[model samples]
Target: MSMLIDLEHVTKLYGNVIGLNDVSLQLSSGVYGLLGPIGSGKTTLINLIMGQLRPSIGQVRIMGSNPSWSGAYLRRIGLCPATDVYLPNISGLDWVTNQICLYGIHRREAQRLAEQALALVKMETACRNPMGTYSLGMRQRCKLAQAIAHEPDLLILDEPFNGLDPVGRIEMTQFLRGWVKQGRSLIMASHILHEIEAVECSFLLLTGGRLLASGTLSEVRSLLREIPNQVRIRSPQYRLLASRLMGLDEVADLRVERELQQLLVSTDSPAQLARTVAKCVAEENIQVTEMRSEDDTLQSLFSLLMQLHRGER
Candidate 1:
């Protein structure tokens, strides 16, 4: 299958400062989560995709065509920038409508689409309000409204839920979910791990302007199989469970936290251990309160990756 976006050994540099470093990526038509910190080249990659900045080296192809070569393909792509772009004193409706007009959409059609987009983000009632009067969350909705108004083939959003509250975030997530359910493509950049996990299991992690890893968390875990996996099992019969687990070849090390009534199990084969432990718990009817893999978290894995990248291991 052909990739919707392809980056071949791409690098972006602003003088001596590196924006991206020999990053190569291919994205098909699906939801992808871009994970990175503030200066990890997330925005630079987005800018390259949006054709706002040209790569210093290598090539970028969007929809099998060079994004910088023409504006035609941009019509099929929607982008919601992380930075603020609202024009004060203008009605939200007028702002989004004006954006649609840039695509040469007829005035009548643009207005209709704008209204529909605003409604999709649940901003129809406040569409006529001035941008200056809108809260941060409302402004975010306006940004989302502009992106989906055109119904582009691919939607790229950067830190899309920055200002949204919990309820607003849930609503926005549902909206994105429904959009992708229609077979359209989406790439979202967010610092929130759970939020990214909520929308997509696959991710591309970046750090220090370099690609750290790209795959599902489970797949990434497979890459660091040598690292001991930590599992914390809490139960009133913790000592019994620990004894059973220690007898298994799957358990490499075991520690008992008596005060916490938890047994920390270290295993080389976490996946297998998880399956075995789960089966044991169910079959034995153990009163296990919690069984979680601490080292399996994104933050922990990311930190380990960074350490490995820096030759700290």
Candidate 2:
């Protein structure tokens, strides 16, 4: 099957500084989150994909065409960069209309398309006002208007949530989700894990100029099973629960939190530990007020992967 994006033995450099180091990955046609901390080459990777910067070594294929030389392939992709382009003097409509005209479209036709784009992003009314007078959320909506005016098949976003309030963030997420439902592809880059999680897409994790991992949430979560897990259990009979858990071979460590009335269990086998806990709850009548896995969260998983990458574990 043809890949949406592909990189082989890719490395990017700025003098001695490595922008992306020996990274290789393939992405299919679907929504994907480009996840990383700041200065982790997320923007660099996006630039390479967008053909703004050619890789120092290795290949970059976007929609079966190498971005390095395939200028025509650009029209197939839409990008809303992380950098804020505040054209203080220009109206939102003019800015977006000008962007569409870059694809060799006539001014009148581009203007019409730009109108639709602005309307889609709920900024058509305020589009006539100078961008400088617009709020950060309004400006971001205008930027999105420009990017989508051409109606590209692949939508790529970098930090698309930077200047939005809670309501704006929800609206932006809903809009992107609607985009995917229309059978289009998307790649959204963000440092905030929950924002990507809100979009509910597979993700590619990058750090220190390296591609650490890529997969759907469940696929990635399965990796957690290979490593030990820390599960927190709170109960009325905390001491009895702790004693019962201590005898299990899978239980690697145990800690008691007197204030919380919780037993923290570190276990290599979470499944077995769960069975034991259930047995103790039913047969011994131990009251478990709360039983939760501390490491089950996406943020914790990302932290674990970061630790593994740094050779800390």
Candidate 3:
């Protein structure tokens, strides 16, 4: 459980604009997701770790060494950039082989590794196609293959699912999950909450270049404990159901949306309230069609955190 990446009081500035401000965090070996909106310093943080940009203040350490350019610490790390800037004229196979060579592998070994990487990304059939001929999703897989060609201990991906369709996204998610099972570490930056939730073992949320929250999904939920949990109940007798739920001490608020034929119930304790409601249904002989929790999604969590931050400002 040693720290793979560590940042202490890390600050970055672009003249008058703040790229990152007094950010400090630690990452261990696992699939960690950096979640944030655009311009929230997600890219800046990744650049700092990659040694592409020096911090204005504080320190950045990757594998116990500073991550500045020429640090040599990057030898143990792999990077998949967010932008599509590959050599347009070169075929995917050639491009991957060239990058492996840059990592100091011999030509024959590099080619072998490149082919294996392509196969891992399911791109072996399309490996000889020129970069320009590949679709955005195909290009992303090619980039991922290149990043893993050297078999580095850690992999950093920025917007890895940026241009993928739904099926492609699912494939990418499954692939990353499998990669982490090999005991390697991965740090992925993404704006899509559902995608991050699917891939992330933990989360580091950023907003306006500042760290908002960091931890597992359950930990993040605890941070928003003040907010009531919501549930929707649908029954044949909506009015009767609403009246009974409203009488419970566990229920803090209730709203009946007549158009939807559902009753929205808010309670301070979701687990306890669910049990109470379940008992009430049995006692009342209510025919329940659907019962579900609302606003439990990661998107809702992010929205709530952003709103809280805005109110503080």
Candidate 4:
């Protein structure tokens, strides 16, 4: 697959503070999630890719061309900014049509594209309403419509799920998923772990303006190979089962909660660990009630990576 976006030793500075430092990455045609805390250079990376801000050092390339205000690279790149700023007096329909025209489409073609974009975002019903009268979610959809008005090859969204209701978030997720199915690529920067998980995209985790990790969820999981895998086991006879399971080599640590009749087990070999637990249950005549991998969740993984990166682990 061709590389859609590339950052080579990119660095950005805001006076004395660092926005990004020696960040290097290559993205292809798929949904990519940028995961980071606030001030971790997520927004800085987005701006750099969208040609809104130039890097202080190194290079940022979108579609093999440098991203700059005058580069015209944005013609093939759609951007939905984090901010909600819009033309308050214009209707959503007019705003999107004007943007399409700016992208060099004829009046008729622009109108058709604008309406299609609004419909794609499920904002056609409120398309005629003034931007000031639209709700936050509606405005968000409008912003998305404007970005896709030209049907760019790459879509860049910053905090797209912020302030959206549950329904809106779900709708947005489905829309993004469908968008990528059409062979277009997306790079979304968001703080919400569940949102990133729902998108099921590769992740680029950043911290303190540095790239902490970048890969698929499972690939990132491999980075913390030394970190113990946490699992919760519930059995009919918890104490007896916990005692037997604790003796296995795969099981490194165990904490039995007598009140809840559950055992929180940390293990090194997740596959062997499961087999060992199964053997214990079979041999000891223990009735298993529940078993779940607790630490494999996206939030837990992010927490672990951030903690390790900060030297807090």
Scored by lDDT, the top model is 2
Against the hidden true structure, what lDDT does model 1 obtain?
A: 0.87
C-alpha RMSD of candidate 2: 4.1
Q: What would the TM-score be for candidate 3 when compared with the true structure? A: 0.79
Model 3 residue 74 lDDT score = 80
Give model 4's clash tally. 0
Better of 1 and 2 by lDDT: 2
User: Where does candidate 1 clash, by residue pair?
Assistant: none
TM-score of 4: 0.75
Give the candidate number with the greatest TM-score: 3
lDDT for every model? 0.87, 0.88, 0.85, 0.84
**Which scores better on lDDT, 3 or 4?**
3
* Residues 186-261, model 3: lDDT tens digits: 9999887677778657889997788888889678657555455788988878888887777787788999999888
Give the lowest summed-lDDT range of ten residues in model 2: 295-304
Candidate ordering by lDDT (highest first): 2, 1, 3, 4
- Which portions of model 1 miss their true places by more than 4 Å? 220-299, 309-313
Number of colliding residue pairs in each model: 0, 0, 0, 0
Cα error, residue 266 of model 1, in Å, equals 12
* Model 2 C-alpha lDDT per residue in residues 1-313, reported as the tens digit of each score: 4588899989999899999998898888889999888888999999999888899998898888888778888898899988888889999999999999999999999999999999999997899999899998898898888888899988999999999999999999999999999988999999887789888799898888988898887776576565678899999899999988886799999999999999999888787888999999999999998998887354556667888888998
Compose the digit string of candidate 4's lDDT tens values, residues 1-313. 9888899999999999999999998887888899887778999988888787899999888878876735677788888989986677999999889888987789899999999999999998999988889888888998899998898888999999876888999999999988888878888898766678787789999877888888896786575554568889998799888778767888889998888889999887667777877887778778889988887455555667878778998
Q: What TM-score does candidate 1 reach?
A: 0.77
lDDT of 1 by residue, 1-313 (tens): 5588899999999999999999999888888999876688899999999899999999999888897887688999989888876678899999999999999999889999999999999999999989998989999999999999999998999999888999999998999899888988899997666678778547899877888988886676475565558889999988878777877988988899999999998887777888887887988877789988876355566677888888998
Q: List the lowest-lDDT window of 10 residues for candidate 3.
A: 295-304
Residue 14's lDDT within candidate 2 is 88
